[model samples]
Each structure stands twice: as structure tokens, then as C-alpha cells.
Target chain A: MPDGFDQFVTDRLDRLLRYATAMTCDRYLAQDIVQEALLRAQRRWGRIGAMDAPYLYVQRMVTNEYLSWWRRRASRDVASPATTIAALTPPVGDPAVHHAERDAMRARIAQLPRKQRAALVLRYYEDRSDAEIAEVLKCTAGTVRSHISRALKTLRADNRVMEVL
Target chain B: MTNDEMLIREAIGEEAGQAVDPGTVLAALHGGRKPRRSRGLAVAIAGVAVTAGIAGVMIPLTASRGDEAGPAAANAATGAQGEQTILVLGLDKLVDEGQRPDSIMLLRAGADGSFRALSVPRDSRIDPESKLNMAYLKAGGGDKGAQATAAEVEKLTGVRAQHYVTVAMTDFPELSTAVGGVEVCLKKAVNDQLSGANLPAGKQTVSGEQALAFLRQRRGLPNGDLDRIARHQAFLRGLAARLATLEPAKLTALVDTVKRTVHTDAALDVLGLARRLTSQSGLTAATIPTDGSVDTPSAGQALAVDPVKVRKFTTEFFGNGPAPAGGGAPNGTDTRTPCVN
Candidate 1:
């Protein structure tokens, strides 16, 4: 409950949650992961808050939480495939036609391997550069680029099948 | 951006755009832990702080005398300037014949937070009449056991430990479960009835009671207690790898379990140890130097180790001096779960 930590939570909690949601594709898991990350961040905020980008450190924590083996094993069945469908379900009575392509894209994004999907989400959704994505992913910039490239290749392959259909 | 990129961004943005409940996060942040505060006001203030959104400034009240460290220093300052040497003892279960210290480890943490552990084989001769393991039973068996063992260790190695941590082998199950078990590799299948271990060769994750058995089996090992020491080192290495990769939530749970399970000296600084565990600073482990097997009148078969060689190995390995250039199983930061006998 230090001033810097509270202020950080007040300002960036929403954004962190959004990023987590995109990465996890499960709102509840996102909430849990973001809360856990922030809890840890606050514990050492005296050091983290002194960093150049405190949010980035917390963001990396959130990413790591989502990528953790236990988290994946626990949330694999409950989230992603099921909750993502629920979230992507077009709202009743709205024009659901134009959303079909975007919905398909979202589904494909969720189907990517967790790391590649993570790289895609960080690069496209968070508007982070490849270097920032590498830092968050704890990989080289070349590795991050490869992840993004491979993910884009998979999504494009799926799109080609859709075009043929 | 191209059309596909635009569609990807829009899809991700739309998928992620949802209102997050801020209350839950604030609750977790404010009400996360009470052990960091004084016992008297922990419950009363935690609830009020969570509900009212008002909490006191982060204070390192327990940081006195280097017992604990402030949050800022917990990472950057504590290990950056000073090192800590801890004597880690694993105690066996009590039966009709009383108990003995199962394993002894000399953990020396450097100023950079990296640690090197020296495992003293339990069968090493402390004197012509007594083995190293007998030191604990010679004295009364609780805290005195740790002190007696530390004294023996200091006499043998000429290095005094700043603190001691003792864990009952009975707690290994819960401790292993807390970290989701640890993966260990076996060079050959084990079927030792004395230790209740029936494990196959190669790498596998052991938890709960199986983990206890895995660490306890020594009868069938080619080197006996020496091989068991290797098993201990392998388990510690696997545990360290697991802990290093654990996320914050699991790390917190593991830390809580450790606080509840392990008994340490008041000045050991558990949080500081946790910080070191979390840091990327690696671990180097080796066993104390030994000559050969000896049939002792007091402790039966024991390893014949000279105290002079033991002190030299400790000084060279734990000291800033170069590691003893020779044949000791000194593995530095390999991070592999070594296949052990």
C-alpha cells in the first residue's frame, strides 16, 4: 500500500488486465494472473518502481504467470476453447455479419501455440516492438521475430483454406 | 499495417476489451500477507485496509540486525554488499532408537546472490570413535542437534556458519508437493526395501511420500551414503530449477509452505533467502573431499576423510579462491537434473 504501488495499480491495472485477458483469452484467469502479478510487484515495488518502466516489469510477470506450467495445466481445459467462444459469441440482435472474419481471426489466434500467440498479442494488441516483446518473453529479438513470423504463417495458411472454401 | 495485420489487431483488441474488476486486485494487494506485519494488528488492519482502501506505508520493521531486509534492499542492496553462510540440516524421523541428522549442507551465498553448497557425507569420520552423523545424537536432539552438528562441521571445515535451518524429513512430502514435485533422474532402477523406494531408472517427477523414499534410499547404492549425497544434491538442483521458474503465485505458496515447515534460526532471513532463490544467480554444489572407505569401530563402514583436506576444499570452494582444481564432483550451474546412482 505504498503511494507508488497504489498509484501504479490505479493507473495501469486495467491495461494489465486487458493484456492478460488477450494473452490468456480467459477473463477470470486474466484477473487472477494480473492480481497475482501485481501482488508480487507491490511486494518489491521499492525496487520495481525505481525501474525505467515499472509497468513492463509487471507485464512480464503477468506473461510469465500465463505461460507457467501449472497455470497452463490448470486453466487449459477451463479457459481458451470454452470461455473464448463465450466471449466471442456475437451479442444478440447486433449485426454479426461483419464480425465473422474477425471472429475467425480471434479463434485462430487462440489456436496458436501459447508462445507464438503471446508474441502475436504483445506485438499487435499491445503495440509493442519486437525488442519489447523479446524482453517480456525472455527471448532474443530474432526469436521473437520468428515467433511472430511463424504465427502469421499459420494464420495465413488457415485463411487460405477459408478462401478456398 | 496490411489488412491481415489490421484484422489481427482488431481481433485481439476486441477480444481483450472487457471491464476488469479493480476491487479484487486491490484486495489481493492490500490483504496479500500478514506475516510481514506485527502479529497483534495483522488481522485487524488487513481487513480494514482492504475494505477502506487505506493502508500504511510499507515498513521493514523486521529488518533490524540483518535478520530481515527492507523490500528495496531485499533484491538490490542485501546481496549486493554482503554474503551469508547457512548450515542446512535435514533430520530423520524419530523411532525407538531416537533420530540422526540425515544430511548436512553448507550453503554459502555470495554478494551477487549466487550460492555454492558443500554436502558433507553423513558417514565421514568426525573422530576415531564417532562418525559425523553421531554428533547430533550425542547431544540432545532438537535445536541442540543443529548446534552440535554445526560445531562438528566448523571443526571439520574451519568455517563457521552464520545461521542454521533444519527440516524434518517427514516434511519432505508436503515441501515437494508445494513445488509440484521435483524431477530426478536415476542411472539405474532402484528397489531398496529398507528405504521404501521402488523407482525405475531415468527421469521422473517424485512427490509426497515417494519423494521421501527417493531421498532416503541408500542401501543399494554403489557408494552408499555418498551416492545418497548425490541424490540429495540432484534433488536440490531440481528443486532450485523448479523454484527459479515458478510464477509469483506458486512461489508465494511455496514460500508459505516453507515458513510453516522448516525451522530456522531467528536471524536466518527467510525473505532474503527467497529473494536469492528467485534471482538468476546460480548454484554450484560439491561434496566434501574424502579418501576412501574405512571400517570404523564406532560407526561401522564410514568414509575415511581427513579434516585437513576437508578444510582446504571448503576454503577453496566457499572462499573467493579458485575451486580446487581436481577430481571432486564440483558441478557449477549446469542446471541439468543429473542422472545419479
Candidate 2:
């Protein structure tokens, strides 16, 4: 590995894949987008890996790749089965959140606008702040706020999370 | 965190284990693409035409060309100079197909790193008898074609240029693909089969054959060739973005892609110009300021451009004052990026 990139990839690849999966709502497309981002990342990894936030940078690239793919897919208007949320098995302790209900929530989340979904994924899934999300999305913090607000509006409309939002 | 938020996190994290094989992804990076074959060059006309086009965007690998340019001349070109100009002509040429000069541009760069380019329409009046687009065909192509075209451009804008380059569209695709495709943002989707451009709306990276079509299609565009000039500016800016990070090895291949049409002048070799504008700054593009049109006794209806207005455009684009009316954004680049469509 060049400059300990092997370790860096090991540290970040899984996290990147999860974020990508959430963004694309498809495991296969997520893998493809992550691979595409990583391929491009390798070209400049020598310069970027030494930066203060190499993983964050690569994660941003993954987001861009997913957005690009999203636009491409949208224009083509092709329907894919995996775009639907997959059913999840409930973990041992969490009986209040039924797996089927979680699946319904995930599907509803996927229906939000791309920016909204990305904001939710970055904010909740990656545990990033509005400023950090802005940095990653290359948008103003206000725009990030709007994306989150609009996204949460949809979530709140769902009877399951009406009070939470 | 709220319980609902915690549940959402847990829901999304279910797929955290999903991943592509890193080894396969890494292996594909270098395995598929090998260096291209056959070297190419674009002959630069020297002595009279200014060699300028937002060289800010199309500049590639001056640092890599250091060995080729030696030390002295390379340094001089890269060092800021006082008052320079060049004529840049972009053409669409395909195998066994007729060639057309679709983009006619003039650029002026003062020593301060400020630059402006005027895109003259292909149908602009050169003489009462013929359109500016026919200059190349009248000269039977190649160097003669570029020279004849440059002469007409000189007449139209009244700017004497000693350096010129006529770049073919054939080479642009390979170059765009080489740089991993250039991102294009269109307010609306373009679908013109005649020029082979069938693109969806928003931002996308156009590569190779598709890019040729993207650069070629002028028909069915909102304002015909006029809008295509904006596309040219945008594509060039994308190309510029790609060039900023071009690898040293790919730079050689890129230079090998274009067939040169002019040769007598070494002062404005493509390599030197490419190196000088590697910085890609203070660039703007405009259509030659034309105030509507009139019918000539011999030439039918023609665009009416006052030389005075053009000079004013020149002044404002270089930051002397406010820009004159009639022109698109300072172009061949994305002023709206980082948060792309």
C-alpha cells in the first residue's frame, strides 16, 4: 500500500459503503458508487491521504458519486427492485421498533429528495453537525438546514414518527 | 439523541457490513486503461495572431513539459508578460466527414493575469459576399484553411493576431475521456441526433464520443450556435478543471491527440501556452458585442457589430469597468460548482 493506504482503506471502506448504501438505497449501487469514488480517490490519495480529514474527504467524494448516479438514474427513469427498502430483522432488545415498521420508515426515508436523504444520513447515520454536513455537501449551512427541514417534514407526516420530528 | 433518532440510526446501520471487494476496486483502477498509441500535435501559427482562449481552462502539464521546453523559454512563457493575444478556432472533424469551424474565438491577456475572450459566430459577416464559416473550406483545409480563417477573423474584429491554433473535434473526445470526462450542466436536456448529442438535464460528466456530440450540436439549441458557444465555454472550463490535476504521463498522451494545422511559429507552440495558463485565473468569455442586424445589398441579413462596442467589451472583461450589454457568463467554467446539479 502506498503511504499506509491499506490501513486507511480498512478503516474507512465499511463506513463509506454504509453511507453510500443509505444514500442510494441499494446495496449494489452503493458498492458501485463507493468503488467508483475509491478508484478516483486512489489517483490523488497521495495528496489527499495526508490531509487532516482524509476519510471525510473520501466520504464526500462518495456522496458526489452517489448524487451523480442518482441524477443519471433519475433521467433514465429506470425502476430497480433494490431501490425499495429491504426488510430488517429486529435486534434482540428493540421490540418497540418493529422490523416491518422500520422497513416502512426506511422506505419512506428513501422517498425524500436526494439532498434530504443525504442530510439525514450524514446527520443521524454519520453523526455529523449541520456545519460538517455543509462542508461535505459543499453547500451553505442554511441550505443544509432547509434540506433537513424538508426531509423531516416528510418523516413527521408518517404516523409512526409524528411526535418525534 | 431521541429514541426515534436512535432507531433510525440502528435501521440504517443494518447495512453497514455491505461492501465491495477493495482489492477488485483497486485493481480496476490501473488494469483497464493502458496508455494510448500514436502521438499527435497541433501546429501553432505565430507572428501575427494572439494565441488566447481562456487558456485558463485548457492548459495542461507545463511542469511536466519542463524537460521538453528546456529552461529559458519555458520560464519566460510561465512568467507574466505584458499584453498578449491569440486566435483560437475550435473545429468539428470526423473520419471521412466534412469539417466545420464552429467556434471562432479571440483572447487578450494583459500582464496582470486578467483575460477575456470574444466568441465570433460562425455565420458572422467577414465580407458582404461570404460567411466567416467558409474560410477553411475556401482554403482547402489544413494550414491554408487556418490562415484564411485567421485573416477573416482579423478583418471582422479588426484585431491583428500573429498566433493561432485550429483544434479538431476528433481529438477532443479522446482528450476529454482521458481526463475522465468533463462535467456539463444544462438547464435543459439536449437531444439532437444530427450532432449526436443526446444528454439529460442537470450536471453530468460527458466523455469521448458523447462529448464530441455535446460540443458539436448547434442545431435545435435555444439560440442555435450562440448557445453552443456557452457549451464550449462550459466544456472548456470542465476541461480546465480536469487539466489542473492532470498526471504527468497523461499530459504527453493529451498533446499527442490533436493534429496541428499551422506550423511556421515556434513562439506560441501549444506546449508553452498550455504551461503558462496552468494557473487558470481571471478568465471571462463573451460573444463579440453585436447590436442586432441589417441586410446588405449583396450579402442578405448579417450581424451588425460596431468595432467600438467590441473595444468596450475588451475594457470591461479585463476589470477596467462594468461589462457591456449582451454576453453570457465569464465562461468555459462553472461559476456554480462544489454544489453541482
Encode model 2's per-residue lDDT on B1-341: one tens digit a residue: 76567666765665344445545544554463211101111211010111123232333233324323433333444545555666666554421124556667776654555556667777676666767767877786555666788788776666766666555333445566787887777777878878777888888888877876776676887565566666766665566556656664565454323212122223453333333444544455667766556566775666666666665565565443444555544452226322111
- Total residue pair clashes for candidate 1: 0
Interface RMSD of 1: 18.9
- Model 2, backbone clash pairs (residues 3+ apart or across chains), number: 16
* Candidate 1 chain B minimal-lDDT segment of 10 residues: B50-59
Which residue pairs overlap in candidate 1's backbone?
A: none
Candidate 1 lDDT by residue in tens digits, B247-319: 5445444332332224455555544443333336566677888988888885788878888888888889987
lDDT score of residue B310 within candidate 2: 63
DockQ values of all predictions: 0.12, 0.08
CAPRI level of candidate 1: incorrect
